[model samples]
Target: MSPSVLLRWALRDSARGVTASWIGGLGYQAGLILLPWCLGRALDEGITPGDRSPLLSWAAATLAVSVALTGAEFAMRWWATLAGVRTGNRLLLRLSERVLGWDAVTAHRFSAGDLVTRGTRDVEQITIWISTVPSLASGVLGLFTVLVVVATLDPMLAVVGLGTVPLLIAVNLWYPRRYEAANAALSAAHGARADAVEDLLSASTAVRGLGGEQVLVERHHEASATVHDRTLALARIAAGWAANAPFVPWLATAAGLAFGGLAVLDGRFSVGGLVSFASWMTLLGRQVMMLTFRFGQLGDAWTAAGRIEAVLSAESEMSDKATSLLPAGALATDGVSVELPDREPLRLPDLSVGPGEFVAVVGPVGTGKTTLLRLLARLADPSTGAIRYGGTDLRDAAIADVRDTITIVGQRPLLLSGTIAENLRLGRTELTDGQLREACRIAGILEHIESLPEGFATEVGERGSTVSGGQLQRLALARGLLRGARVLLLDDVTSAVDARTEQRILDGLRELDVTIVFATSRTAVRDRADRVVDLGVHDGELVSHG
Candidate 1:
């Protein structure tokens, strides 16, 4: 979606809250005019005329207005908050789903840290804007009320009223654009810094092992300094606008008061009319001030909205259709080609697997083994390829249907932060204790789980860091098997484990009826595979063994 489209949706979602906030500000602004009128009346008929009765009555009226304004203010705030919170949630969820739906190669194309930043930090910026932005509309309404109140008291003062508003508008529009440009720079610098930090965090051990702390630290400092300069530039713009706004109003109000005083003395204006002019000028000054503040908020929101739009606008690698059921235990790939940007495509010619058949992919590094496996699993699509299940092409097949029949365990296994049983039951919610235990046993992770204090309930740290690499791989295998996929793609899963462990895992998988396609660097490993295809590169293009 475009930035404009995203913002339109955001506004619609938060309309109720935004409206509430507007109402609250209007009520407070109404009190601005009413309180001034009450004071002017008391001065004219009570204090100046030495009438105590009128003073007491106007005092009670002021108190009642104050109470009502307070309620209005609170009510508006409550609703605005409600709207903002709900909008944030919906946008967050929507953005997250889009990002996660993208393919592995596509997902990795964007920085993980930047995505996290957009989801969180960038999202926060809009909330700040919402809190202050609706005031602009309310302030305009308040200005109108002030002008009418002045016109009723004296038509002469109303003639010069709002003379400075055009100039104020020009300044508000100009300053915010400048502020936002600087903020854009600031946001870019911060996102770069986040990417750098995430890179370092993920490779902290490697960096420390290689004694590259200084290099990382220097890179971090450079990123941080750029962000600091951009932030200061944005602040400067805001400061300039804020400092100048008040002065413009001061000049306008001063001109009105001096001219207004003389007109009254000349008998062209009344004492009560001059009182109204003073009140309107005060109200106008505040309105101008609020106008400047809202401009800054909108500028900030515009900046944030653009970044969020970029992420949400990102298209998935390929569109997935609605879920449709495909038959069980069948797979095929016909003249598949895996295309990488700025690189020649990798080819797989006519590979098929029957129900209960085990197949393995063997090739050199950079060969199409892993790529072929990825295609079969639909983790990534093959350019100019036909992947079919039973008699239907996978492209025509519902995405969920394709996924339902195939599960892949990648070279580097990922385990969610959960107990062993919880991780195994990820895809299958209906797994019984016996079934869960059986899958774990088949994957050879049952012994490891039994060693832990909590057995199957033992907590796995973030990404399964609490377990050994061997254990993580085993857990992944258990998850795939428990899903009962008719086909399983194993991509160098044994790379982190010993030969004994690898043999045992393979032995268990060998007895399964489901197809198993494994990629391995060693010839010995491939020899044991049910079927092996050597990925031979000729003329910088790949050809499989016939």
Candidate 2:
């Protein structure tokens, strides 16, 4: 959806709070506008004419207006704050839901850090804009009220007030476009910097091992410098508009003072009338400054909304039709090929695997073993053809059903930051400790895990950084085994383990009733398979032997 449409929907969602805030703001402005009139009444009747009765009455009126102003101000701020927070939280949840559902291809469209900034800082800008809306509306309304009040006192003073509008308009006419462009540039710079920082954190170990810390540090520094420059640019534009816009109102105020002072001296304007107009001129100056700042905030939010819109607009290439149900039978591929970006299409030869069979796919590097397994597991869809499970086209079946039936474990296993057992069980909190240990034992990682200080409760750190590569692979494999899937697609999961552990894992697999499709270059794995599908590069094409 476009940013405007998104904002409209958000406003509707928070309509009650926003409306209450606006009402409070209007009340506050009314109280402020009335205070000057009350002061004028006190000066004219009590001070000038020396009437105790009028003085006492106007004083009470002034006190009442002050009390109402305090209450209205509190209500205005309270409602604006609550409304902004509610809208921000709703937007954050929506963005998170969309991000979590992304496929690998869709996820790669943005860096992790960029997505993080979009969900956080970008949403915050929109929230700030929401909170500013009531204040801006009230300020404008109050300024108009001041002009109307002054026109009644004297036409000359009203002319002075009206004169500022053109000046304020001239001051602001060039600011919106400039501020918006600067804000957008700054947002992009922030996203880039966030991406650079994430890269530094995630790849610091590998970069230091290669003695390339300087390279990463230099890249981060460059990104930081760009962010700094863009921020300064946006700030300068905003400051210029703020500094200049309010000054026009001040000039108008000075002109009103000079004109009203002459009128008072000539007995054409009363002393009380001059007092009220001068007070209004001062208030109007502040309102002009406040409105300019709010407009700048609006520009900031507009740019942020566009950035957020970009993420929400992405479309997943995979189809998710559930018209056909997956059935129990052999798994097969027909004219399957995947067209990768800037590379030759990866072609998989037609093949069939019977139920409960052990099939090993042997191939060298870049032979498309991983790609083939990904398609089989429905992690991705084939670009050119179909893969069938029980004669049902994989695309035609529900994605959830396919994933529940087949689980694929990659070479580099991902373990979230948690205890070893927690990572193994994932969300299946119902699984007992015995069940977890059984899966780990089958994967040949239980011995190592038990040797740790915390045993099964050992923390793996982020992405299993605290564990060895072999241990990570084992943990992931164990987790997959616990699922009890009908078919298991493993992409060289044992690549990090020793030969002995590899053999143990293979032996453990023999005890399971599930169909196994293993992709690897290891002879130890191919020798033990019931059948081997050998993939080799021929001339300019990839071919497979069944």
- Winning model by lDDT: 2
lDDT of 2 by residue, 1-546 (tens): 667876776678777887888899999999989998899888887674645787888999999999999999999889988998999899998888777666789989999889988998999998988887888888888878877887888889988888888888888898999999998888889999899898888888887878778787888999999999999998899999999988887888788889999999999998888888888888888888889989998887888888888888787677788665455678888889889889989888777877888888876788888988988988888888899988888888877788788899999879999998889888898999999989998999989988888898889999999888888899999999998888999989999999999999999998888889999988888878888887674422323333
Q: How does each model score on TM-score?
A: 0.87, 0.89
Show how many residue pairs clash in every candidate, following the order shown: 1, 0
Residues forming the 10-long window of minimal summed lDDT in candidate 2 = 537-546
Worst 10 residues of 1 by lDDT: 537-546
Task: Give all candidate RMSDs, comma-separated.
Answer: 3.8, 3.5
In TM-score terms, which candidate is top? 2
Quantify all predictions' global Cα lDDT against the true fold. Answer: 0.75, 0.86
| Model 1 misplaced stretches (Cα beyond 4 Å) | 48-51, 131-133, 151-160, 256-280, 322-325, 340-344, 416-436, 454-457, 507-513, 521-529, 536-546
